[model samples]
Target chain A: MRKYLLPFLFLFLFVFESIFVQYLPTEMFGSDRITVPRFLIISILFLTVFSSRKYGIIYGIIFGLLFDIVYTGVIGIYLFSFPIFAYLMSKLMRILQTNIVMVSLASLLLIVLLEIGVYEINVVINQTDLSFADFASLRLLPTVVLNSAFIIIASYPLKRHFEKFMASVSD
Target chain B: MPQFFLNKRLIILLVSIIVLVALIGFSLREREKVTWPEQFLKDMTGFVQNALSGPTNYIAGFIENVQDLQNTYSENQELKPRLDKLASLEAEVQRLKKDNAELRDIVGKEDALSQYEPIQATVIGRNPDRYHENLIINRGENDGIQADMAVITANGLIGKVKNAQSFTSTVQLLSSMDPTNRISAAIQAEDNKKVFGLIEGYDKDKKLLMMTKIPYDAEVKEGQNVISSGLGGVFPEGLIIGKVVEVENAEYGLTQTAYLETGADLYDINHVMVAKITSMSAEIQEELQSTLEEEEEEE
Candidate 1:
């Protein structure tokens, strides 16, 4: 049961992202800016940095597939993008310092990449007609700001938890 | 370059990219219904989502109730006059409904296009990705919901069921940018005249529905109520869609287009009713079937 905590955490974030985040009053933004909570991916990035990359990639693939199947019409967008970003983040972390600020910055970078990648794919598949300028202003900027705030609040606790879990698993 | 090709990680990356493209292409194709695997997954996720959102919805509703309390005095003052009118209007509607039914009985018309069974549903989850603009509802095929059934709130038409799983259905909002997302709508002109057109697309920036293909000379003015025409044979007739906001010439003056402001707030929706067209006579059903076949052949 204790071993399932990480996966449970991911699942909670996954469900919360789609369900509860919507209840956050959009009027708070005062403009029609799309703020998608990529908390699941942010936590997954934390797992990659603090725990094992192998487990992170596995969790990414599983949750990514779930996200695709449950939320979006098209499959493989999140399925492909999530694990790829997890892989890329792991590689980037190897070269950079593993401080909280550095990890948060890296997570934000991954979030931007994932957003742009998904946006480009949607454009290619003609799922959206939003121009790049509009996407940047309406979606990308707001999403980055929202997720960065999430990271700022969540990173310390998540990192400490993952480190403790990793130690226990190794032991 | 040679070493790059030799690397195992690069090979996995290239292979996965190919797989991704293939999966995307497969999912993008038009299908009559979602496959069983997709359906099963949706049901599983939807069950969890339903359970999770129930408490959250209650909390949100409580907050909304508190907000409503603050404006209760002003709202009551505004609605007291309307309450008297509503009583008379209800009586008039009942009288008219009886008269219309008697007339239809005399004419041997047992079925009407405006008939539908409303299936109550609660939104369990919305697509976090804003691009698709989809909602997952608690009701599904088990509740007699089918693809293309109009989903509406108390205000007006919101969208239609994109697909129905066993226990959950996906609603594609009218605001989604899909070329094939068209609805046959009619503008209620003065003197009970209706000018027909198709709601072709959504103007995202302006947040309005675009009703197009109106004849250039049609007298569609601003503020006219738009309702589903029932010519598409999917959505029931007289379901309020929106009110026209602006009109302009299109196709080099061959046709006109009108922008409509939807009554339903597409952003904040919790409950919806799937308008399941009910009790159509055999003749009308056959006519609809033949028209559908003819259109398919034309395509």
Candidate 2:
């Protein structure tokens, strides 16, 4: 039962982010489109922090492919970006003492990198028409704010879960 | 020492990049149908989306209903005059319909949209990518949904299906700025002149559809209603798209561009009706006219 918790949580986050976040009132955003939730990726980053970095890379690939197959028109954008960001975050964590503040800052920095990475790839393929300035002000800023709020709220509980999982694995 | 110089991690990185490029190249072909693996995953996720959306939507609806009750009295007062006007217009519309039918019979014309069949579906999910405008709905190929069928709510046209799986479909909203999704639209002038244009793309940030190719001399204005002209045979005739909110001169042409505010609330859609045209437009129109002429000759 314990073995299933992480994957189940990731799946639950995916479904909720896709379906429930849209229910948020547009008035809150002052526009129709809301920021895309990065909760699933954020949860994977948590795994990298507490349980194991390897698990983060593995889950990122599996779930990222599922996201690509289900939602995106193309197949490889999220598939590669997710695991790369996860690995990068875990590597950065090694230099700094891991705490809610440090992890939150690292996650924010990594997410920004991921956004820019996706945008550059999209531009190369001529899939996006948005200018960099507009993309930054409109999408990246709000997304970072929303995901930061999520990290602040979930950090402690997720940290505890990851530590437990790590301890069990060692035993 | 020489073997140790070649890192396993570097090789893995190189291999993943190649795999990534290959996957992108493969998926860029624009296939008519999703492959089996994609179909299977979409179906499974669709099931989960539907299962979870049901109870949550119910709870959300309940909250909205409670809020609506608070506004009911004022809303009723505001709607009373419109309700009276609507009743009178409904009767007038019925009379006009009968008159139009008689005129059509004499002229050997058929209903402009008789080829369409509409299927109702519930919206289950939105595109996880904020930049793209796609909605996932509960109906798919199993319910006879096909690519390019127009999806509309009670108010007006919202989008068309881009992909149809066995149990779910993806609707590319009119707000999608893809160059390939142009819709043939026309403005019904107050003087009864029909001016045509193409809804070419959308401005996502501004939440407006960009229509082009209107003749410069055409009498276009803000607040004019735009509807599908059905010139392309892809969209059926007279589907309400939106109302013109602005008109501007073309960047470098003899044409004009009109920006339309879509009537359908793209932010808060729940249910939609997908319209499938059963017959080819030109063939159906010709058949109807020929039969009507034959009957008249017999008379």
Candidate 3:
């Protein structure tokens, strides 16, 4: 049961991201629709940074596939993007320091990359029609800000869990 | 670690690419149907989502109510006059509806115009991806919801059912800028002659629905109500959509375009009604359109 904590946490974040995050009273933030916080993606990134890149990839594929099947019209986009981005972020973190601030900044940059990558892929597939300018101002900026705030808040706790998981694996 | 895992990363990359392509191909098939595995996942997650959303929504609503109280006094002052006017209007509208029904029966036409049955549904989830703007509602095929059924809130039309699973459905919002989800709409005229047009797209930056293809000579002005035209069998006639905020010439054509501040709360909708017209067949729709066109031509 203790071994299952990390996966259970990821699953809870996934459920929260899909259902409850939208209700956040962000009308005070702006006029446009508030991009709900991507807690699931952020947690996956934390897993990637603190644990093995391999764990990140495996879990990314599992949860990413679940996300695709549940929410999106297309299936492969999230499944492919999540793991690839997680792997890339883990590689970047190897060079950067692993403090909360550094991790938050890295997580922020990677999320921007991930959203833009997804947007570009969707544009190529003719699934989305948003222009790059609108995408940046409306979606990219808000998502970056909101998810960065989430990272700042959850960074310490998430890092602790990741270290515990890593310890358990080595043991 | 097995001896066969020498090129693990390379194999993983290859496997990911193959899986990605296969999933995309399968999803884009002719029917666009969900496989059993996907359906099972959706059902399970939908159940979980429903369970989680209930308490969160209640708490959120409570927080919102607390914040809204400050403004309620000012809003109440504004609504008092409107309430007095609305009571009179309500009685007059009810009388008119009965007379119209009697007239329809005398003309040997059934109540095709106002014969939609609405299924109430709770919105359980929304796509976190801001670009898609799809909503997941709890009522699905089990509640007689089908693809293309118009989903409306108390204020106005918001979206239409895009897909219907066994216990849940996905709604493609009116705010989405997708070209495929055009709504047939008309501006309300004093003389009751429809100024028909298509709500062709959306202005994402301004958060407005874009109405297009209006006749160059039609007198479509700001502050007029826009309603679904029932030109296509997709949405029923007389469903309130929005109010026109601007009128302009089309970018490259002879037609005009009107932008509407959609009446429904696209950002914060919790519940919706799916308009289901059971008797709306292609043949019936064609007949309805032909008669409507004949009436317009005579006028």
Candidate 4:
């Protein structure tokens, strides 16, 4: 029962987003930066922290695909990406345990790479033109800050929640 | 020796299986409708995100408020001299408003123009993976939103609705790199020249838009405007697409590529107009005209 509860938390969050939050555009202090569906990042982080690498891989794919359906982005953008991100985050978390700073940096790196990878795909697919100005400020820096901040705040809860859930599962 | 020979054959069989799998993957991609099941762990992602969103907003908002305060304080110090300039600017703005109203009155006669119907949506979800992936909108079938609906802000186009539910829909942004996003557009100022091109997104800081297939002879001076051609019926004509930023005459071909500086801040979208398309198709036109001509002849 508890096993279902942990993952259900994530499912509830996603469905809630589909129903309520998807409409509320992310307005930060009145500035609209490049706000993609942010829940993916938080979920990946949360699932990776709470569950094992295998579960992360499973949930990551599920989460990413749901995001693609929800957003209708490159239909497979998250579907293709989330499992990889989940698998990676899970592996990295296993070894890089106990340091918030390293975790923060990892989160920042993950955010930056996610943006960069998307841009790379866009260019390769000729979906849009490539501009240097956006590469610098609009696309990269803003998401980096946003993703990093999210990971920082959630890091504690993610760790605590996952730990409690894992312990409950074992018992 | 027989055992060694058998091991070699087994290794070769394994290699062949790997190669076959790879070849099938490559060939299958062109028609792959790969989708949702792969990424979505469960719907619960939203609840977790909802939990995380609070404090994240708080901290990010705090930083921005501080930044805005600094900017406002600095502006306050420079307010006196700018006050006179601002008065002149206000007068200029009023003059422009009158001119705009006059233009609007004239253009209002052209009822064929695309009418903007607006629906307000929250930016509840961002692209889960990448910054430019796409946006999920809460307004869906219940709001009368259908697939291919043009989503826009008070400023400009965001993208079109792809998949919709009773309560929500997914928007594929103009920034999405899908090749099918080719938009037919017209130059804002020239009015006579139309550019059939695709708006491809790029790796720029401000979500830059680039247009290809500007007639080699088109007068695409920098700062000239770009607007949709209303060709595909996805967007209305005359909505400000962007301003021409860079016009290129590369030696390889007799085509011009223009960079349009997009209008709306793609980062912050609130209320967007879903243009209800009301254009007559050529087939419909032909049928109606032929019937009218027959009626007149009988008379």
Docking class of 2: medium
Q: Across residues B88-117, which tens digit of lDDT does each residue of candidate 1 receive?
A: 999999999999999999999888888999
* lDDT per residue as tens, model 3, B1-299: 66567788878888878988887877756455667787778888889888888898898789889989989999999999999999899999999999988998899776475468989999888877655778888988899988889999999999998888899998988977566888889999668878999998888666688999998889888899999988777788889999999999987759899999889878788889999986576778788799989999999
Chain A vs. native, model 3, TM-score: 0.91
Better of 2 and 3 by DockQ: 2
Q: List each candidate's DockQ score.
A: 0.70, 0.60, 0.57, 0.18
**Superposition TM-score, candidate 1 onto the true structure:** 0.97
Model 1, residue A104: what's the lDDT? 93
By DockQ, the better pick of 3 and 4 is 3
Please report, in order, the local distance difference test score of every candidate based on alpha carbons: 0.90, 0.85, 0.83, 0.62
Judging by lDDT against the true structure, name the best candidate.
1
| CA-only RMSD, every prediction | 1.5, 5.3, 4.8, 9.0
Indicate the DockQ of the complex predicted as candidate 2. Answer: 0.60
A1-171: candidate 1 lDDT, tens digit per residue:
446687778877888998854676363455677888899999998998899899889988999998998899889999988888888999999899989899999999999999999999999999989999999998999899999989989999998999988987987
Highest TM-score among the candidates is held by which one? Answer: 1
lDDT per residue (tens digit) for residues B1-299 in model 2: 76765889777889999999999888867788889989889999999999989988898899989999999999999999899899889999999989988998999766566358889998888877755678899999999999988898989999999999999999998887677888989998888889999999987666689999999999898899999988766788888999999899998869999999998887788889998886565777687678889999999
